[model samples]
Target: MDILHTLNIASSMTATVFRGGAGIATHPAGAQPEMLLELYDFEGCPHCRLVREVLTELDLDARIYPCPKGGKLFRAKVLELGGKTQFPFLVDANTRTQMYEAADIIRYLYSTYAARQRPWYWRIIEIQRLLSIIAGLPRLGSGSRARPRSAGPPAHPLELYSFEANPFARPVRDVLCVLELPYILRSTGCPAWGASATDPAPGSRNRARLQARAGEISIPYLIDPNTSTQMKESADIIRYLLRTYGQTENGQTKK
Candidate 1:
């Protein structure tokens, strides 16, 4: 990797420190959205980080639109729809509600989907904002700008099996953010706190589904139905996304 890219990945890894270790922990929501929730936010935004962290806490999947500053893809769309450009804008078709502000969005998700009040820790708006900002410090501007797109776009939204704080998974999400590609975030973080709990153990009650589908329990998996591809390793997944969607000289994909 180039110096800039290496620094970018290293910065992203440190971000996991402030994420409260929920990235790989999936505490299933009481109910999943009938339609996937749509979130418009960039990776490096502190406000956006709060919303995504809550998503994993609730085990809720969303179709994320990366609205990095100066991004041409989704930022404009958010402006036209919400009447102002904002970070962490949430569109919930289930309730026909589209709104901004990270705290309000977190409350809505927990109350509506989790069937409970928002967790006490995140109920403090100021605390959430402060921590999220600190979390964004390491990888400042990494995922807050749109990338150069040179290849054809995917026919459909991709699916990624990940949790927010997974160090290995952060780089993949960062790439998607810059590319402004939407995907369903399948969180596979374990619920328990023991050593073996990091993996999707049987006690989590979700591991069986993963084992049956993917043949083993592991995360940071990328399943691209657009190309009929599924992969587990983080490094390989990054390379695959870049090869398929990255800009190359002469407008041809890397091969």
Candidate 2:
């Protein structure tokens, strides 16, 4: 792996550790919404991170619309839809529910889908905010700001199999956010690390499908139908995205 990319992964690992691996496990949701869930959030926001972890824990997939700061894309859409600018807004068309505030969102998700009371730890939103902010420090400012998009969005939303707090997955998500790419987040959360590929949670449908399709359960796996590319490994994915979307028509790479 490239040394800087290795360091980026290491920093992400530290962030995951600081958050206590909140998104590491999959809990069976009471029901999957008939309609897709929509999440409006940026990658680096602490509150957004919390909401994402819960989504993973519940093993729910959602359509992710990245709203990175200074982004001209979905940021405006969120304001128009919600009547205000919020970092982590959720819209469940299934229930005609639209709301903001990470704490409230977490509660709504648990009550609506999981049909279980929030765990004691998850209930402590204050502590969660502190820890998540601290967790974000290692890669502060990244995935928070938008980079200019040289290319328009894909014909179809990309698909990514990942869980929140995954060291290898975080970087890929960051790039997607920066480029303002919408995607289907396939929540492949496992009960534990090191066992995710060899042995996943018994109820993890995403994991089983991933294993059968990819021939393994290794994560941060990306499928870009627009380009007909399915790939693994964060480094390669990042390079591919930058090359495809972060470059000028004249073939100049843009930061």
Candidate 3:
């Protein structure tokens, strides 16, 4: 299992390389919005991946609504509002603006949060989209489709501290996607010890908070306020998700 996990993440890392560091660190969103941003996306979609990358890079937090293929939860809601079933649709409550298309969402994020123009690479639109498709190839649709499960919504949005390309973090995001669970994605694109004036911190509490819980700061740290659990290590986190949410690690559904 460990070897397979390593191989899985290695390919995810390779996909990150292909993305050219889009979600690697914080870029200091200009005048943060009071309302949390919302994203309707599935984990394995290349188009959705680009929008998520920018969210991490800008160090912005969002309420993620996973709309995996064939998922009944949020797909209908998206279609009702947007008039189509599209992944990576963004809704900004702060501005009451909603739109589709990866490139457009990226531009909106930069304009609204980063207060800058979209990067040049994004200008080449076609190439960027192609690379995103390639990135999803390795994960093989782990978060691309929904699965059978029984559960009720959490009282609060689960928070995840993850950088877009963290191989370890990808699996957690996948499970969250599969369950259609909403989460606040807190990105550590530029580590605290490495942040710049332009690149702000992911969050102040993340470092100290993880240290207190995991004995050291780490990526893929999960904070499930509903369960009052904070921990690291991907496999353990997956198991906890199953148990806390009522299921088994072997993929058996619980009633």
Candidate 4:
């Protein structure tokens, strides 16, 4: 990564630390998914960040539909389904529940999937929300703009193995959100083994191992099952998405 990019990521990580890692801890409850939970949210929204952190803490995974501001797609779907543009909306296929607001969603996730006892720290939802907003200020207006192209939809939903706070992965998530593509978000959290001096960071070694299992050592790795394509690097992923799914200059498919 270039120095600037590295600094940007480091800055984001610093923000999470300042916020006391509010949304980063795992729940005593374990992973349990009969059918994937679905979330309609943008990457940079503070409200959305709260719910995502809970998902990571709970060690659960979900199908994410990126709903960036002014996104032509998915935003309409949210209004059609939920009657408003408010975000951090969640849908649980297992119970057939749909709702909005970050606090409500976090409570539901804990009640439905986690063990009975609630964490006292999470009771301060409003405080967390405010801090999340403060935390998001530096990365303002990112992952919120509409790009000027449209590629055709994929034959299958792509898969992204990532955690919410990875600086390298966040930009890729932003692009995917703006395009409103759905993907299986496999959360690769910290390693079962401890961190080391040679490691990229706390979870870097595990992320690399998981990527290697999928045939790589880098991230933000992407796998397009539709085209049998897989690659690493945020720039390449964005270029591929625009080339494949983004509209041509004439406002139609490239080909």
TM-score top scorer: 2
lDDT of 4 by residue, 34-58 (tens): 9989999998888998888877666
In model 4, pairs of residues that clash are 149-247, 150-245, 150-246, 150-247, 151-245, 151-246, 151-247
- Native RMSD of candidate 2 (Å): 2.5
Error of 1 at 12 (Å): 3.1
> Candidate 3 residues 1-255, lDDT tens each?
678777877877877787776667565577677888999999999888888888876777788998999887899989999999988899999999999998888888888887677778778878878988877777777788876555666788888878787778988888888888888887655553454323224443344555566676688988899988887888888777756664555656542
State the lDDT of candidate 2 residue by residue for 1-255, as single tens digits: 499898899999999999987888887688888888999999999999999999898888999999998888898889999899997999999999999999999999999998688899887899999999999999967899888777677889999999997899999999999989999999988854345443444456788888888998889999999989999999999999987888665657654
How far is 122's C-alpha from truth in model 4 (Å)? 1.4
- State the lDDT at 188 in candidate 4: 56
Top-scoring candidate (lDDT): 2
Better of 3 and 4 by TM-score: 3
**Regions more than 4 Å wrong, model 2:** 192-201, 248-255
Please report the TM-score between candidate 2 and the true structure: 0.93
Count backbone clashes in candidate 2: 0
Per-candidate TM-scores read 0.88, 0.93, 0.87, 0.81
What shift in Å separates residue 156 of candidate 2 from its native position after superposition? 0.2
Error of 2 at 31 (Å): 0.8
Residue 2 of candidate 2: its Cα lDDT? 95
- Which pairs clash in the backbone of model 3? 24-189, 25-189, 25-190
